[model samples]
Target: MESQPHNDRLWIKLLVLLAYKTATHKHARRLSWSSQTGGVIPISPKLCIKATPFTQLAEANAMRFVAQHTSIPVPMVHCAFEEKGQTYILMERIEGDTLAQVWGQRSDESKARILRQLKGIVEQLRRISAPPSIGVANVDGGPIFDHRLPRKSSWGPFATIQDFHRELRSGIDAGDIEDDASSPGVKDMASFHEQAWQAPVFTHGDLSALNILVRGDEVVGIIDWETAGWYPPYWEYTSAKHTNPRNLWWQEEVDKFIAPMHEALEMEAIRRRFFGDF
Candidate 1:
């Protein structure tokens, strides 16, 4: 294993110690500040907690599903509940730097190793049996008809790929595709809407490097299951690619790590162009 720098390790150890102390104190305010990924507070060396404005029951369930059914490295959900308009999740804290933080510092061989692990993880996820519906799965393996969107309101637990596609084109149906229907992207969406998709499968929904934790050449954990659900097989590739479209390096990461779904990406690109305003 390629170890993290000595100073980084020391800093992490210190944080863990402090967090452990706080958690051990029975009445200590359960608060540790993190501005970037809001409401995540390290509670202890072994556990962390997250408080979010949105409901995290789904996220907790998703993490549990992955942890139980697959060999994928993910945090163990200790407990999750909703309170005062916020959901709180307490989980195990897997220690590592995010792949995003260290990818550029790695050797090609290390990168390849990481990708192989991720490929195995994806294969395992696909092996999970899914129902006919296309949507997020509940804890008991039922579809959640209203899946939350990354940017705005919930969208689907669509019955089919066509239903999902129609939802994408709904902006035009609502007369909001764009200010100019003549815009090339708008016109492209109209054409792309007719494309078909393969049967639904389990998807991470958001699989950017930031969500993948790395320790040395190994993938220690895959985090952020908030958007995980059942979707068309190509959903993973298209969604990961969309995370940082203009960043050439991230594009390379998507290409190297995620199986390409050119047609799917093309359709997804069109959908975003059309409904992005919403």
Candidate 2:
């Protein structure tokens, strides 16, 4: 497996040695003060005594995925500890610009380039064999990702847009929802799926570009898996391009950026349903 550079390892060994002799339990702190190796300055190792094993496992798995898989980039894990309520995880850091940095300056050519790259990343993610699955345990963290859905019946299919609008009014009347809850994207999807349409796909539940890293037009890495989970097929389709108001930061560019892709995903879902295999 591709591993940390030799220099980095040597550097870490020095840090470990330093930790062993510290006056206080200042392991990573003092090491970082004098650490000036490869322009890499790590955050002080967190006191993970309160972290659950589940968090450590998630960090471990994310590292493994980054190390083993070539599609999406993630951090590399060097060491980990899980005991009682305490968890310790060590991993290499990555640096890159975010996709949002370029969203605001969307030129015609830049727009096309970013869209193509985004599409390619999704296609690649679809090809990645699902990551290892972990069971529900009382422990808080682990190497495997558990992709349980957040909630069920959040939304469902509608026979027509009219039916969706009616429900929307009712929901809003009850003060349980916002007005845009009945958007064209959501309303149009009413007849397309059902409670049973949900599937088990490994997903980075929070897929916003803010969580993504970019080098030029390429998506180099995706970060922040705290909300990662198994999600339905079309779950991301709506917002992938819809540029929901929730992500107001990119709202302006999102309309043009995701318009075409959103259209394609919608039609694609329709085709799948018509094939009877859906």
Q: Which one wins on TM-score?
A: 1
Global lDDT scores for all candidate models: 0.67, 0.43
Q: Per-candidate RMSD vs. true structure?
A: 9.0, 11.6
**What's the TM-score of each model vs. the native?**
0.77, 0.49
Assess candidate 1 and give its TM-score to the true structure: 0.77
Give candidate 1's root-mean-square deviation (CA, Å): 9.0
lDDT of 2 by residue, 1-278 (tens): 11122223555645533443352245345554333222122444431111222343444444465446545676555654443444444555556666766666666786678667666555554455543432211112222233332122122233332332234234322223222643434433343322233223444544566766777666666665543433344434443443233666654544443334454367435433432221
How far residue 125's Cα lies from its native spot in candidate 2, in Å, is 1.7
